[model samples]
Target: MTEATVGEFTTRASSINRALDQIGDKWCLLIIQEVLWGINSFNEMMAAMGVSRGVLSNRLKWLQEVGCLRREEGVAGSHRPRYHLTSKSIALYDCAMMAITWERDWYQTPALDRVELVHLPCAKPFVAQLRCACCDALVCLRDVSYQPGPGATRDVREKKVRRRSSIAITEVRSEHALYRNLINVVGDRWTSNLIALSFHGLTRFEQFHQELPVATNILSDRLKLLVEEGVLEQVVYQQRPLRYEYHLTEKGQGLFPWFLTLLQWGDTWCDPQGRGKPMQVTHNPCGEQLQAQVHCSECHGVLKAHEVRFTLDGEDMNP
Candidate 1:
């Protein structure tokens, strides 16, 4: 593997990066999703996720090592082992919902369309929505501001990082995934990092390069992919020598909820040093700290893991 500098000079520590380091891989996220949906056995996960035996085994071990999953003995007389989500992994439920919401909004995901989400508290079908806990107001990317938090530190990144995977998400063979498009975008560590940096108002290529410290070619390829995916649009900023600035499109802005939920999850579960938080976000409209909450669109009630159920083909699949 070739070496890539994550950061040459000091850069602010980010919970998002830490979280990505653990679960940002394409297979890793998909495996976690499968386990969350009750597909925990090795063979079950392999068939459901369309992942190879070796890759699946590696990711399963990695997940266990990272505290996202735990290996448990199967039922009495069974020889196979099973995987289960830990509290840390379960906390990612909000991110998953936001991802589903974004995917349904952007693409015609038949699998997602067939699956129905029901909020048990309200006893009604609903869509997921993000709201600020401070005032119960809908949270938008435009209305959020952030600054360094107590956990913020100048991080000197590792000099050697793995090269990005060559395989594209669309090329992966998955038959039962709800957030395929979302995965296609953020499944890669660097791609997700770019999206996170964009939320911090980064635009220019040089700006992203400085913050990410990825190889120039890899960074360029990711940017082009984002543009092709319609998440980012390039605007001509200079005519001489042809310079441009990247700006998020409407579709990209729609991902704010997902990223916000992920950031909160990272802050809670990925902080190894117990540093408070890497960044503090404030709701501009409410003038209070932003505390994100996922709620049901139909009832406006907060969503809890045990308080949600899924229905597929008129069959209740409660988790």
Candidate 2:
């Protein structure tokens, strides 16, 4: 295997990294979002996303390879094949909904407000809430901690140098899709890790550097990207040299649940030994251990994969 691909295979055994590697790119998440919205055919997805046909084709192939989606041949004489979400991708609905909730609260815009999700069983407009699966209490940053899991690997020296790809988001139009915008903000590992650290009260550049061990240039690039995306704002803390600290904006803070959900998933699945969770979470309000769980807005019942249905423009789509 190529050196870079080898590095990815070894490091991405961690569930969170695997998840990000699969769906965290600028186009992958957008493609999944579009598929969920019922844009299935290649032509439809290409038109809706305004993405180059080559990029779209590549992402679709990757998603299918990863078992998140599948393609079915078109009827008898048709040339187009329809893309459908597999159970794996369907399970990501909670994550996407949590993202939308965050956007609704902190990144409000006219275009965003036009899209809405209604729980078919509830028949009322509502937002997703993250509750502790064990005790049914809300979860927060203070409630969690982490350690190495079964899949954890000690740091290794690279056998070869890898080139960095240029950031693609800069070329995307400002008026592009909201999910695409969100992807630009936190699509990369360093940026997402920095945002998660911000929730743990890390702000200064030095603090992020110490916790992450990322290269100076890479860390700087991610911080600048976050600032430009408005997820983080820089405040001057030292005047003489104009040194600054990175602080999470409302938009960044609102992403807590999304990251928290990812953490919970990693802690559960990545640790095979049952030795212990990589992270332990406690619901402060209830003073009990926690796991992030999605619930129905109206009934307050657990939102299981099979129990829910979807609607697009008031038309029911089978889940």
Highest-scoring model, lDDT: 1
Clashes of each: 0, 0
Model 1 C-alpha lDDT per residue in residues 202-263, reported as the tens digit of each score: 99999999987677998899999999999999999999999989899999999999999988
> Residue 121 in candidate 2 has what lDDT?
68
Score every model by TM-score: 0.93, 0.77
Root-mean-square deviation of every model: 2.3, 4.6
Quality of model 2 by C-alpha lDDT: 0.68
lDDT of 2 by residue, 86-115 (tens): 877877867876776676666655545655
Window of ten residues with lowest summed lDDT in model 2? 1-10
What TM-score does prediction 1 earn?
0.93
lDDT of 1: 0.85
Error of model 2, residue 188, in angstroms: 2.9
Model 2 per-residue lDDT at 313: 47
